[model samples]
Target chain A: MPTVRINDENVTFNEGATVVDAVAQTTGRELTAEGKPADGGRLGVAVALAEEVVPRSRWAGVELSEGDQLEIVTAVQGG
Target chain B: MADMSLPPLQIGGYSLESRLIMGTGGITDLAALEAALVQSGTTLTTVAMRRYSPETKTSVFSMLERLGIDVLPNTAGCYTVRDTLLTAELAREALETDLIKVEVIADEHTLLPDVIETLEATEQLAERGFTPLVYTTDDPAAARRLESAGAAAVMPLGSPIGTGLGILNPHNIELICSRASVPVVLDAGIGTASEAAAAIELGCDAVLVASAVTRAQDPTAMAEGMRLAVEAGFHSARAGRIPKRQHALASSPMEGRIDLT
Candidate 1:
């Protein structure tokens, strides 16, 4: 098992895990290949890997690496 | 009487009927924020992007969605152009809107916008097809440059962020508004409803208030007051104020005082 940092938390996952798998494991919501929620609800989330934002369309192809720093952000109350 | 004299504040493809843009920063309770937001009569509101937490229960995005208010996501805490662009991209992805409030702060103490980086970010964001509403200082020249950089709107700060010191330089604000081709929105340092009105009276198309209403003792009351004040200011500006005179000019006719003579 390899560990990756997501939202400052270390998560262990098997090798060959895609970004979508990482997101699904962390958020508990499955995403379609198009990066939408499997249930057709609004996902309302975005992911940045190693300081570079990964587009939703590429989430399925981008595989996670060991010690990769991931940032998953959403809208919050602020100006 | 409600004043419906001015046209809607148009930016990019969006037309906002209300000129008051409420900010959600510093709000303690979501229910309270919703009440104030409804009372404010604002068609647009601001939200910021942060790391997602599963344990967090309150969803401000869902609340704004239910209230039918358009969310204007901001790059609030970004200090560099890179950070600003990244935050803005995230905002657009998560929120699914191209409207981004481009705020490139200088430092922590003052939290003033870094105009140099801000200008660069605005140009880049605009090039990326995002409607960048840039937040800059109350500098007329800077405002002009931002508008030239393809900003959808230029938000000039009244003083500093969350200081509540009110507009420190009305002359600069008026200058920015006078020459701006795009919409001019007074962004920060508003303490009360009067300041919100003052922004409009100074020729701003709209005003963005956060700490004033969200941190007030009674947020709902202040929100209502802000709504009324903005309306009053719009009408007063259009009504044409009388010129200032050095000497007293009595409204009563002097011809009626024959007995004193």
Candidate 2:
């Protein structure tokens, strides 16, 4: 089992969890068939692991360990 | 409808006929915002990133999608290269676009770009193969450096953001335009129609407007004004103006002037 911090929320998951498993636990959202952090319309959310972006392609394969830091962001209004 | 006859404004792989790139901010009404988008005839516009909030949050993303308008996601409040990089990465994953408007500010009071961080972010973004439209100061030398760093566009403020002060340093804008190989964008400090014209005439490839239009009491009319102003500015630039003189060189020939004058 690994304890990872996502967007400042510390989430613990079953042992031998990948980055995908951590994201599901952290955001509590369902993954699409293509296996991305998305909800129907895709909030345009981006995820970063350890300050480096975890590309969507590699999300399923990259495993997470204890204390790994994650950041999730989405598009908002601005000038 | 935007006139398609104008010479296209090209940035990276995108080419837009309209030189006005509007910002989706200030105005709270969604319908009115859509109306303003159409009125402005802007091919590209900006949106900022925020932490996701689901319960009370409705998607402006859907509204933009319905309008079929392309979005240029921005890092509006990022204070450092690290924050900006993450924000930009999020925007890309969420928006599925490479277009980013990089705004790395030093503080909220000034809302101005931090020169050192802006430069650093631009170089890194380019290295990562993302197209960055950097918001930089009006320093021509810095503008050159940003271009060298592979910025898709160099957007320099005419003054501070939202001040409506117009172009406080026209010469610097002109100087930046004169040297830049990439498009020079006049961003922020635009208060009215003429300033937009001046920015275009000074050789800016495009103008990014927000408060001057979206916040106007008459936003719809203001939006139209911006559209026409951008075209007029581009036209005037192409038409070419006579050199400024200390004394008037009479438009009417000397011989045509009345002797009584």
Best by DockQ: 1
Report the C-alpha lDDT of model 2 over A1-79, residue by residue, as the tens digit: 7888877878887777777665565456777535564656554566788778887667778888899888766666678
> Each candidate's lDDT (Cα)?
0.90, 0.83
Please provide TM-scores, in order, for all candidate models, with all chains considered together. Answer: 0.94, 0.86
Candidate 2: residue B211 Cα off by (Å): 1.7
Tell me the native contact fraction for each prediction. 0.79, 0.69
In model 1, residue pairs whose N, Cα or C atoms come closer than 3 Å (at least 3 residues apart or on different chains), thus clashing, are none
Q: Per-residue CA lDDT of candidate 1, range A1-79, in tens?
A: 7799999999988888888887787677878878787987677788999888888889989988889999998888898
Clashes of 2: 4
lDDT, candidate 1, residue B87? 96
lDDT at residue B110 of model 2 (Cα atoms): 93
**Where does candidate 2 stray beyond 4 Å?**
A1-4, A10-30, A36-43, A62-68, B1-4, B55-58, B245-261
Model 1 lDDT at residue B246: 100
